[model samples]
Target: MAPDPLRSATTTDDTAAIGRLGAVLAARGRPGPVALGPHGPHLVTSVADTRRVLTDAEVFRFPVDVTRRATTGEHAMVARLRPEQVARGTRTFEAELSRATTGWDGGGADDAMEVLRLPVARSTTDAVLGPLETMCRDHVADLVLDWVDSLAPIIAATRPPRRWSRARREERRARTALERSLEDLRVEQPTVSAVELAAGVQVPIAAGAWLLVLLAQHPQAAAAARRHDLAVEVAWETLRLRPPTWVTARMTARSVSLERGTLPAHAVVLVSPLLLGHLPDLLPSGSAGPEVFDPQRWVGGDVRPGSWLPFGAGPHACPGRSLGLAQLTALARWAADRHVVLTEPARIDQTRGIFPSPALLRCGAVPSSPEE
Candidate 1:
């Protein structure tokens, strides 16, 4: 009914609004209908409160479409065993990631960063959507961008009718491509496939790409990530900073006092992981030094229980975290990291400009081998 913070972040005038979100989330209530309406603008803090609200599923609901409320009927049906299925799907996801990384490597040939982008997407697509009809080693960058926009238009006001129409057609093609591939998988490896898992793949893949973009920018952090026992820290760090879903929305089920202000039913709340990740006090840059890259910061503290939310805090938390972690690990282990000379990192744009991506990350690769 009102302005959508998620949508607003992509516009020209969103600078102030996005800044409001950062500030409000840094100090106010957990994001949702209540704090959003109560505070001067909308930026949600209170990770604990946000977790509480999300955990109380009966109160906060998410729908796949506009006409519905709550995870019921089709939504509930799909989510019923999502957790179990995701666990089962992980093995396959990992296997594909491994293949993507090493399938082309030879015993005596030079190994590059394995030519990232497309290969990641190719195996990712296969893992999520079933083996693609073709084994395209190259990822479709423009295709993926168009697909994301089609799902959530960056420019909401108006797209050229022809452009929108073309996107719609391409979107259908992508799904249909997956569907056809799924059919083939069923015929060959039916034991390993599940429709729900297929459906869940896109979100994580897109989120995975976002992680790549984020990690590539911060090489020092990426170096820290490389030293880890597992890449979960890397995934968590990226998520803590740049969550794929900027703001999670909820309608006030009843009157609520959010400390910042009073909120009535139907008000929307906003939550901010971006603000929470940088809480200098929570991260105390003490004798451990300036708190630059402490994975241990999340190890023993009260962080994951409620306060720190990279993959959200509660029940409706993102379920695709494991798959994301696997993908990150696969990339990390196989990485022939070229020094990250970021030409321009992603920016919070308010004008007619594109969101940040690795346009020209000019760095020499430390190829996995010496032979040419």
Candidate 2:
């Protein structure tokens, strides 16, 4: 059978490529751990198996030096921060969204991803670094985005490149720029490091873009977002379908048992939240389309949301998840008020985390009830 075009861009070397490989593994129907690619890195296909690997952080510890060694995991910082911090961050995000969308006249063409860049960046920067002069905040946001872009090639490479490679050099330069920009803040907030701030900033930018892309593609979902208090559901639905960080890896500390086989110690283990999201049993039964975008499915409350672990699960799950959802929700409201339509097909770019490149969207004000 032909590959499912909905889940892919039909590109030979993109996230679709990885999705195709995942499909093969999923077809095996709970087959024991199997190699994800040529040399090694066995994949854990089932949710139960994936959860076991993530939860047992001791055995599958995060590879902190991922540039030099294999690695993948979510944040530890989210758990460390106080609730008030998160609340303050959400407020910052709302303010930033309004500031970012100011010039969007509701009748012009703009790349949805591009539109989100400033607001998401500014919001996250404010949340992480606290109040800053407008110029400094904008400059810092731009640097954070540049650093994120620079890390792409390093991440997408099958194996870590040599220390002096061009990709590594670019990543280092970008990282230095971002760190230098944050140096003053580092001194002020001794406990909050620059690395944590960058992670907190970057992921939401991508995830927020993905949410807009999903809404633009699915009109019903988009309409629901505009007409109701469903940003949380919309955010969850978007994450379910196209989580930016679709793939994460862990190295086994010891031999681990699978349904069909045993993965020896020090083996590379792969898990995909995208694949888990597609499992029939995990989603609502009467939703008519499990694979299609349907935010309403979340309204019934029959099934638990986020079983797919969009932000991740266990101890290593994303710390900024709640805030990330709030940021997306804020954007969703902005998007909801506008009649946003895709100007071009949004292609999946997986050089870094999965995101919609060229997510061009045109926006017009949604008719008010009186206008309607």
Candidate 3:
């Protein structure tokens, strides 16, 4: 079967091939808006077009109803966090990853998703909720994962599930569990709401898990990370290839002119960070090899990151982006410090956000040098 652009972006074992496919589509199609499917939304293909859509909130409003319902209100929060708070969260992430992975000795394989689950869950919980008793934090973490998992089917469905449907029922149950757990925390910190906490907790888990999967698939990048120099670059490279929230949708509040044609009002506009990452114009010259996992390309810093907007853009952009990057960077470093090898092929799971399911890996801790 020929590549499906959406699936190629969302579910792929070979990123390079899929990226090539995206590039071809971008080049051959009209420079402006392109129809995604027979009757699906229109996709904005160019970086300039994407930025315009994300920034011009007056013309392109966030499809809040779609995102909020798919995520069960967890996507509602958008509080901007300070640098100090993000630093603290980074510390939490580092500590949790070290503790969670310390027991691994490369003696057997472990599921990357399972290994990252508790560490990411706890780190995000601590970052947003502050220090709490182990029991309370763990309880909240479990609830957040439950809510995140339940929303997966709702997001993947072609049509929204009915109120009485099993998917909706499960999502409601999970959200209730999370809200109940947040009650006490909300009372203590009224300004920092539970919705904010949920957003912080859920996204990191998915992103962190993807970080591990990428490291396992690309041993060279993983080795660079272990050397203690490429953690940030590794994280950025991974985000470029496999952003968790790969596609974001917006509704055209009013008619908007584009390079190719005019978009009608109320038209659903699709902007995919994954697709943008594959665009040659937005990348460093001669470094447009989107299929390869090469962190060294970021060394010179000629090509600015965030052009793809992995965490999104404009007023509704992710407030936790810095924190998310810090957390993923820490994970990259941790993976670098170990000799991680993939135990099985990783496949993309697109039930909600994109992540590598069954990302089984094995690792042995890197011995410290005498100089250290």
**What are the lDDT scores of the predictions, listed in order?**
0.44, 0.70, 0.70
Query: After best superposition, candidate 1 residue 296: deviation in angstroms?
Result: 6.1
- Candidate 3 Cα errors over 4 Å, as ranges: 1-30, 64-77, 187-192, 225-228, 365-372
Q: What's the lDDT for candidate 1?
A: 0.44
Greater TM-score among 1 and 3 belongs to 3
Tell me the deviation in Å of residue 44 in model 1: 3.9
Q: What's the lDDT for residue 254 in model 1?
A: 63
**Best first by TM-score, ranked:** 2, 3, 1
Per-prediction backbone clash count: 14, 1, 2
lDDT at 2, model 1: 19
Give the alpha carbon lDDT tens digit for every residue of 342-371 in model 3. 777666676665677677778876545312
lDDT of 1 by residue, 239-306 (tens): 55445455555655666665355665555555555555555544433413222334334544543522
Misplaced by over 4 Å in model 1 are: 1-43, 63-74, 77-149, 152-219, 224-230, 257-262, 280-307, 313-315, 336-338, 349-355, 363-372
The TM-scores, one per candidate, come to 0.60, 0.85, 0.84
Error of 3 at 72 (Å): 15
For each candidate in turn, give its C-alpha RMSD to the true structure in angstroms. 8.6, 4.1, 5.0
